[model samples]
Target: MERRLKISSGERLLDRALDEGIALEQECGGKLACASCRVVVLQGMHHLVAASEDEVDMLERAGASAPNARLACQVRGTGDIVIEIPDAELPPACAASSPVRVTPRAARHLAAQLNKHAGAVAVRLAVERSGCSGFSYRIDPAGAIGDGDAVFESHGVRIAVDAASLPYVQGTLLDLVREGLAHRLQIDNPNVRESCGCGKSFSARSS
Candidate 1:
């Protein structure tokens, strides 16, 4: 059985759970050295703040790279969010043979997005625990440089990424393709060893 916890602004999900007298695991003393406090975010993603580099590293090692998987200790701020603490162990790393890339058109498209959002710096790319393949990307507009984030620029367009997302998207080739009068981003990732039939997520090719 799972229980919901109430939290306020500036409060962390894990802290609220502990303060509410819930028995939660903390194998690494909440230092993010161990991936013991993994949680599957059910809803309210925009309201929840982004995770840090260390937290992303821990979660990636645990193979919880879906769009919804987040370390409890890394979750910040208070929002009406739903999450499930899972009983699991840290998994292995995803190794890629190359680096991430983007097409000229995709770069231009991304730049357009940055221009649309006033003061936006770039686009942030991260992996979330999602899809049948156990992993997916969570991309969004970036307003500033984040802690431990890798910034990539091409054709004057920038895309920020966390260390955890490196292996999964290293060999990725991003393009902005036009489909039936609609333009959308397309990703041709070589690190994907397997993907679900629906094509919403992917699994890393173990090296």
Candidate 2:
């Protein structure tokens, strides 16, 4: 079925489709690393940039059926377009199964940071629009829990997650791990569908 999906100059096809509530399967998180997000362009091929060399390679490997077949992840929207997901399977409704988990390492790190910053009260978790993926995680010092906020104590530190941000980070594990000489908070989120090459942003859908 052809649907009118408005594609901005830089938005990806999958992201915009989701924005319009048209769910499409994208198991690889729109990383351009999987075939689950393939679609056949029904019109507006010229509106899209020609497939990248790597994209062409991936498509070739998948034995994609047509000249108009393209990876939704690699295709940036330049104008309104028509495309079809040939597979008949219905897209699943994505939702978080539970709140994020705080690992011992992460809780310890949060405690230490909270101690060091005497003015701080707790760690606030937020999800912001970022990266090639639609969102990125943000952590900050929250003096007091906001309305509809999920606040609790884990390990030795207080953690707060607003209702809106809670779902995106659901079933995630936050931990502090050593990456060389520096320490980093590792976000082990199951909902993450794809992350940008630089790791600055990621795209995720609910499960």
Candidate 3:
């Protein structure tokens, strides 16, 4: 049976649903970390997947009060269902938003280049204060490691992040981009708020 998911205000319901063939809005490409893809299941709640610890934690952080609200990425169709879309969750600046994603090749290349220069490659990913929105990613060479940082390795590249930022970037994919004379790192973040026009800074939802 077909199921329906409703989007809330400022939410991109149809766009995201169509992108994944699930009839939901995923302005950030269905990244669970971003709340834009959130939905309110008006019916058939039993047919949806159970919420994970991560999802619950994020919802709490987002200050969502609706018991039925769920991230579309975390919900899979099981049977016929109904949902409602609200306008408050929709961002007025959706048109100007750019979602970032990372590629495996880029990660490997970055790791190799860093290793060549530093002998030991350390890529520190952190959220910094910048841009008009008040927050942006800060990628710099890690001169020393610190506590509360989670480390992950992919294709010889080491990724380090503090405990606080991990929840926001956990499922994120990283990639590099070159547009005209501009070369920059693109983050396929599901937890991003509207980024600055220059794409250097982002303001994520509270969750």
Candidate 4:
């Protein structure tokens, strides 16, 4: 959808596009923390401001190092410019009723772990904004379902998640992965777009 617009001097590209009713994704509210607002400059690149070192590093980390790629939030246009907004719209979040599956092996493993903590009713699974990749999963033994918590049961084991964490983890599968002699618990999430190299954090495809 190519549309012509008159860009003013020092006008932020994101603001202008949004004002024109473009649904560009800015997951971090244009804070440069997420590269969801990346746009490919088709022409008039010279009219746009150069990207800062921070923005460059962030784009690199996000694997958006195209020659013409630019963060819509980071650049301002001084004149008419042609740019293409990629079809990188975030995936729609799953409904609250969507279930997070737990494999039988994971259920048994988690059950044993929960048994060690007396009175623990379920394992709380939540996501927090952390690490370079955007979010990290937090797990804790939940004693009770708190306010705005959604509870799910699988194989006699219950998993509790806060309302805020539900979208990022919906349709996720909890499994026990074995590699040679090593074994670890893994989260197979459908909403995750990319993960940190160390596997400690992930960036979700958010709407």
Whole-model lDDT values for every prediction: 0.72, 0.74, 0.61, 0.80
Q: Give, for candidate 3, the lowest lDDT window spanning 10 residues.
A: 93-102
**Backbone atom clashes (below 3 Å) for every candidate:** 8, 6, 30, 0
Which 10-residue span in candidate 1 carries the lowest summed lDDT? Answer: 89-98
- Misplaced by over 4 Å in model 2 are 1-95
Once superposed on the true structure, which residue ranges of model 1 sit more than 4 Å away at CA?
1-97
Where does candidate 4 clash, by residue pair?
Answer: none
A best-first ranking of the candidates according to their TM-score comes to 4, 2, 1, 3
Candidate 2 weakest ten by summed lDDT = 88-97
For candidate 4, the TM-score is: 0.53
For TM-score, candidate 3 versus 4, the one ahead is 4
What is the per-residue lDDT of model 3 for residues 102-138, given as tens digits with 9 covering 90 to 100? 3555576576657666644478778866788778887
Ordered by lDDT, highest first, the candidates read 4, 2, 1, 3
Query: How high a TM-score does candidate 1 get?
Result: 0.51
Off by over 4 Å in 4: 1-97
Report the CA-based lDDT of candidate 2 relative to the real structure: 0.74
Clash list (residue pairs), candidate 2 = 29-193, 29-194, 94-206, 131-201, 133-202, 133-203
As a whole number from 0 to 100, the lDDT of residue 137 in candidate 3 is: 82
Q: Tens digits of per-residue lDDT for model 1 on 1-207?
A: 356656699788889888878667789888887777788777776667888755764554455646788877878877777777665433333334444556667777888787888988888877777989899877788889878877776456777878777666764657778899999988776667788999889887533
Error at 63, model 1, angstroms: 28
TM-score of 3: 0.47
